[model samples]
Target chain A: MSNKSLIVTLLATTLLSGPAFAEDVTLTIESWRNDDLTLWQDKIIPAFEASHPGIKVKFTPSAPAEYNAVLNSKLDAGSAGDLITCRPFDASLALYDAGHLADVSGLENMSNFSDVAKSAWQTDDGSATFCVPMASVIHGFIYNKEAFEEVGVEVPQTETEFFAALDKFKEDGSYIPLAMGTNDQWEAATMGYNNIGPNYWKGEEGRLALIKGEQKLTDDQWVAPYRTLAKWSDYLGDGYEAQTYPDSQNLFTLGRAAIYPAGSWEITGFNAQADFEMGAFKPPVQNEGDTCYISDHTDIAIGLNAKSENADAAKTFLNWVGSEEFATIYANALPGFFSLSSFDVAMEDPLAQEFVSWRGECESTIRSTYQILSRGTPNLENETWGASVAAIKGTKSAEDLGKELQDGLASWYEPQQ
Target chain B: MKSPRIKSHVIVFLAPAVLVYTAIMIFPLFNTLRLALYTEADQVRMFVGLENFRTLFGDPRWSESFWNALANNFWFFVIHMLVQNPIGIALAAILSHPRLRFAAFYRSAIFVPTILSFVIVGFAWKLILSPIWGIAPDLLSAVGLKSLFAPWLGKEEYALTTLALISVWQFVGIPMMLIYAALLSIPEEVLEAGEVDGITGMAAFWKIKLPLILPSIGIISILTFVGNFNAFDLIYTAQGALAGPDFSTDILGTFMYRTFFGFQLQLGDPHMGSAIATAMFGIILVGVCIYLFGIQTRLKRYQF
Candidate 1:
């Protein structure tokens, strides 16, 4: 062939061959896990990429505080990533209602999730699955074991013993009984209200009843918990209101406080910096020998964007997320959080094993205030936090908080019957 | 004869500005006003007229927070007027003195905080004033004023005032620069004439310099009023959307944000958020109108 003809033939051949070569598909996954970027980059993405050739995963991480706003804006612009982080209840519901989340009901791994895990990421009608449940977080008190031993106080199992333990720490005068950071407001609710609120509400049934208007927040059952929170506030030490969430965590890690109530998500962080041995316990029950309810709610779940051009590839990524391999990687990367799947994954961290031990021993697992509050009105979460602060400061009585809660609920809650 | 035609250049120059302004500012303002008259229920939006306003002002749950925020907003503006403006004027007067050393350096140093983002300022102040951290307390103790130190940002009684002070500290440079420029524009001959008439230093500033800068002061006052009323970022960064310690630091901006966007457990109500915005707009409009008609007319501008 002539030189010109050969060059042209090579160009045409290459051009024609391009159609036969499979293009690499990039699935964008957005999460508000800026702190754990290394985990996703080094472990999760690499594992997924290795198993599935010709498919590349791009992870976009945002700060936790601004994640929801950023995600909403992306969804509104119809440019959200293929796989998105899904917050449980109202946040997930809103996206599902807007048809932004793909229905992955028929995925084979969907059957692996427990009913509780499935329900958390399910639509209101329970007819379709919108996300693959990833992990569940437990909330309770993380105590400084050395501080407890120094004060000669053992972990309490009931309300009376808990108070006695606080008194002992108070008498010691060196350590704060409860390292509460009320300045952030939500920390108080996350550490105290969610951990202890279920005791008075009587777990899931009572919360559901409250939602249905069968029970009022002002009812006698709630007064005890409110009063208990108020009493617990006294043990938080001086200038507790000025302490921030990170401040409280620091206090606990430094052994300045005996106990710090927080979620399982904090375990990985605490383990890295804590000088003292750390231990966690379920909040004590009100009545002696009564079973305690632990705050075990879905923490993070991955949803496929319904409008994504690469839905099939996204589904494949999500299916692998539900597999045993992904669960092992995820659970190990963040040690304390338990995987929602029924796969036999061994938890390596002793602290994580301590928390996981409660799963079988506790009377029941309950949702936090984030999940139980009515979705129709302005968020009751803030109101509850405000009430807790007010109760702590003696600005509002328990009865006053109860009435405030009822008024807040009355804004959007209607009687079901 | 044909009617006079406007020139193409006029249309071309005006079109871009007008189009940009309408798209960004005017359109959104009207749309928010329209949204205020509607309500959403179970995914359906319906016209509810002034019912949202009634709910905002009448329902005890909503009204309490609304009134609290409005009152707090007013106090925030008052603090800036009473504290920031006076300090700014004083600083400007001192810096305007002809023989003052390093005047440019001082001016730039004072203006530094104004350029910092609200998030940075909020968190920085939060850390500095934190009782647990002891930065402020330690400083006070070093000066033998430990007894005077308090958790100013955490207390309900002091949180709003502390935040207002922080904002004032950041923004006082704006008024200082404007007043300084006004002071600089005053004729040296006029001041020399004043000295011939036995006026000098403090007396000269009070009689001549202050009067000449009255127009600038008036402008600064209106700007501070508008800025304070619309303040949200600092409070949100420092206290969160709840604006807590019992919502003592809550203001119209935070209230509107929480209502419009919703927080944990609460679904957003755009209509109610719009109503709050409309309320804020009305307040700002009234303040601006009062300044334009009542205050500005009385403050005579002296063309030096």
Candidate 2:
């Protein structure tokens, strides 16, 4: 056969295969997780397509940084996909207010989620929900087990012991004491401040009080975390000032750093890269007998596009997402992202299991600067990022950082004023 | 007016360029300036004449960020002027020597960075300077100067200066090429006149070559001003949108972008962003006007 005829025959076969048994509905999902493209195509779509033979699903993602802008343009042009992956809090809430996202309240299995899980994507008064909660990441310390053993240190349960362990590792000089860096800014705020903060502030109590204007940032509970972070700088090692997020991750995984102040999302990546046995411990309590608290921050969710043509099929997929089966597959696939559904997912990764196990022992609350506190000018979340970095670098005193944050918050936030 | 047939022919010939420019450039510029005059209240865009500007200048929250960015931008331009252009002129002078060898090779090597993408240059420099994976410390240690190596990009005091130097390294080639062309264009007759006057070598270049290239220097300075004001990609790639270690490297372009499109948790406020953009346009306009009317008119563009 001639080469041209062979090409024509291949094209004809491809064309003929389509519409042979056309699916009734094809739903396209828009997400910022371009990393999960294969996970969606190979694991998620296939699982959904199996049970629902008449429906097909497609997963399309943009670069994480560009997703919001790309989605906004697509939505404005009425060209967006059927399903939209939601960011936690105000970003997604703005989309819902603009009528871009359909309310997914009373969705199938929505009852499985707690109010805290749903709060991130809900209305201010908690009367309406826009997105089905997907996952929450826990904050803690992921440590190198070999380094701990080699340095003759046990997992630190109190702030005093935590520092002692760090000193031991620092003294040995075989490894850097801590792997986290302040260059990226978010790690200082998220993994360092929020992780250890809940214990000081007593979790939801401090967070709620701050929202109600009952507690200012200058309050000892709020300011104390900054004081703790100042000491973190000492163990961050030489030339750590310029270290980025990926560089910190490499330092920890390469067994060059003893402890990494981390979010649960680091589990899968750390497991894949590290040859050393890894273990996680909850954020150290101030005292040995203190009640512990964890920042189990709700990070992501899924929502239906208000303009989706096939709402029924889209809902079917969304409903499936809120199911135990989907939750198990997702949670196990991405170890750190614990499903928000209350169906009791058993995380297969040991480090992930260690992180999730904290929920039973510690009081859980989301990051303090999230929710309504971050909605105004001098956004508390962004402000916290700077304040935390300053705190860790010892550039600003804890009391001064607190005052600066409080002043910024009071300028616009009504309750704070 | 011309004859109807001639005018129609003229219109037909000019239509595409006119329409394309209006659609892309003129319209957007006007629209952005118009947007600066409005504020979004309850999702309604209402005309509030000069209110946004007042807020930008008088409101400490906005003004602090604005002034910081503006100051950083000036420093960035100064670095380019003080370091990049002078070095460029020196290089062009050296390379322009009558007996210089491998001149073309040297020229191409320096110009290579100018053609490279900003993202690649930013990331490459980031890795090269990185303490952990980088060989910078090793290289310094090889010379017994390891203690001198600090994380230049991470320190707030040094970040903007470090970034400015990186930008200079990338763009010094442009000024070099421009000044080199200007030097090459000076007629051989002028050099003969200089030789006759006993003004050969350094004296010949300083007295003869330097004066002829003054206009080129003026043009390069203005181009540097405009380019520096509009720079966003390098800082955005290296320092990120926040332009940290506490926004030390934040320039007008990054400031406008952050306000216009938002960062992590901050939502976009187009009106405020437009106001920043309009301010930038005004600054550039004043700079260009100063170059054109005040400076350019005074520059002695001598005839051959």
Best by TM-score: 2
After TM-score superposition, the amount by which residue A230's alpha carbon in candidate 1 deviates from its true location, in angstroms, is 1.6
The stretch of ten residues in a row with the least summed lDDT in candidate 1 chain B is B261-270
Model 2: lDDT of residue A195: 91
Tell me the tens digit of each residue's lDDT in model 2 across A141-195: 9999998998899999999999999999989999999998777889999998999
- Per-candidate fnat, comma-separated: 0.57, 0.55
Per residue, candidate 1 scores C-alpha lDDT tens digits across B108-181 of 99999999999999999999998887689899999999998877877899999999999999999999999999
Residue-level lDDT of model 1, residues A286-306, one tens digit each, is 787776678787878999998
List the DockQ of the predictions in order.
Answer: 0.62, 0.72
Which interface RMSD values do the candidates have, in the order shown?
1.9, 1.0
* Chain A only, candidate 1, TM-score: 0.93
After superposing candidate 2, which stretches have Cα over 4 Å from the reference? Answer: A1-24, B1-10
* Candidate 2, residue B126: lDDT: 91
User: Largest DockQ belongs to which candidate?
Assistant: 2
